[model samples]
Target: MDAVADHGGSLGRASALFPQAPLPWIDLSTGINPHSYPLFDLPATAFSRLPEPARERTLAEVAAATYGAPSAANVVSAPGTQILLPRVAAAVKPGRALVLGPTYAEHARACAIAGHTVAEVRDFDALFSADIAIVVNPNNPDGRVARRRDLLELADKMRSKGGLLVVDEAFMEVGPLDERMDGDVGRGGLVVLRSFGKFFGLAGVRLGFAIAAESLAARIHGELGPWAVAGPALEYGIKALGDDAWQQAMRERLAADAARLDALFADSGVEVGGGTSLFRYVKLPDAPALFETLGQQGILIRNFIWDETALRVGLPGSEAEWRRLEQALAAWATRRQERAMEAQP
Candidate 1:
């Protein structure tokens, strides 16, 4: 497992790294939705008071319904998915932990933090050997999905051995519905993590949930303790998660945006390998140069430390932002062409 580097949405670091670049940088580092869920006025108590127990329960119920968890008892709320990573890993005692990669680096680091010897395996079959096996559904960076039936079989194997199977379904909001393991967590030996911020475009709200059997859910909830979530976060999460109409509309919009992005990349002669609608993964020899070009032009996309040739580009927010991205890619393409011509005999 590699030490954690900047994990996207790093405009401050980007500003310092590219000091001379333009102002108001376009940050498309993470897979967060560019068009955020609508915000509204909150009651004064929601800000001045600790989140009421009833409100918290309501939020949990809403989350459970939204994510298709069996019930509110199976869902544990947290400040963010990142906070739940180590807790999820710690649910099982330290042992041989295997993470399916190249995915989110935090999973491996979290397992190590939980006192496990962490190994990242690319093959699905290889994961069956570990005491703790982690799979990111519709995996990050690349949208490779393990089938639901395959995952259930793997979970059954791990469960039989008293091991844990962790499925990070953070991107599943935009991924295949049938492939999600949220509904199966009640079968035991599995934990499904759902991220609200990515789909709702409310990362700043710091909301995430873990779905598992009631006992495991309780254990993870105990780790969080009372009032783990903030007042503003509770308000935003409750209102947004329950709004089914908004989510459906947003999903459709994101699909359209993803198609537009694919077309845009194709015109620039870049191939999109795979990614959820919220982001697109581009793996190319010139990915490094493209990353630099975007950064230098005040547009920041996510680049990887482990895979030098891989970059993740998120959706552009507005028409202006889209045009800017287009212009930046055009500039990079021109520079690339000029270099190719220079090498010609």
Candidate 2:
């Protein structure tokens, strides 16, 4: 297989290599919501490969509306954010870019693929002081969000130096859709990439978009070619965009689910570090052990190998799933306590 296993809780690759286990694992490593927007209502005609003008208009309008784009120039759709990242790197040709540390590794990977020297802003000062910054809003893995004003200031500095500021807003819509840094994109050097995968549960559908000024949008679109999105992706993308009711309900449910995740961690002595409504990043004394324990119980979660001491886990959809995770954590805690007791003087 040509695929890389970089994501949290990707057992499919492993399953392909080895004999599959009996009980299927509940994958929580992905920051995506377990309660997905229903796609059953998508038009039967969506499967056709014909150029869908109405579908295209709906996608463009709905995406633009959701992001509160200052102008139609602000929105460009993609198969998913993954493909768009490479396209943006190709279009912008940014060199000496600084990626926020411990972010989605794919950002750096994309920059590297584009032949850019990707330096990580590791120290606190570099993070606050980088001239060109690619900050992932509600960052991946660790889940920390940068302050808005600080981010704006960074963008301004980058613009002054003729550098670009790219932010991955993939998880931003999980909270307030309006919290997007829309006004800043027109400042000439800023772009925000949003994903339809996480919040809308459209990961398999591969829908994502970018918000940029007209010039930049045109340039990026040119590099990406016309009609980069598939027929099913484009059709569903429009339907997904036009549906505000689903977005509202998802937000409300995720907020509640996030609260429950916090409580579960607090009760079990696992310190959840940061996340808004969609996912939570946590630090446990023994994240690998916890990951194994949870995995054995068929409750798969995200654990960063680079930081073996921390893990990221997503909240489940229903109360039953939540209860299952809660019980698994309780059992894991008891095991830890027993191990500690064994080592006591």
Maximum-TM-score candidate: 1
TM-score of 1: 0.97
lDDT of 2 by residue, 160-201 (tens): 776677888888886444446865688777888989878887
Ten contiguous residues minimizing lDDT sum, candidate 2: 13-22
In model 2, state the lDDT of residue 126: 72
Residue pairs in collision within model 1:
none
Tell me which residue pairs clash in candidate 2.
Answer: 79-206
**How high is each candidate's TM-score?**
0.97, 0.91
Candidate 2 positional error at 271, Å: 2.6
Report the alpha-carbon TM-score of model 2 versus the true structure.
0.91
RMSD after CA superposition, every candidate: 1.4, 2.6
Residue-wise lDDT of candidate 1 within 1-345, one digit each (tens)?
456875998788999878988988999998999999998998898888988888889999999898899999999989999999999999888999999999998999999999999999889999999999999999998989999999999999989999999999999989999999998999998999999899999889998999999999999999899999988899899999888899899999999999999999988889899998999998999888998899999999999898889999999999999999999998888889999999999
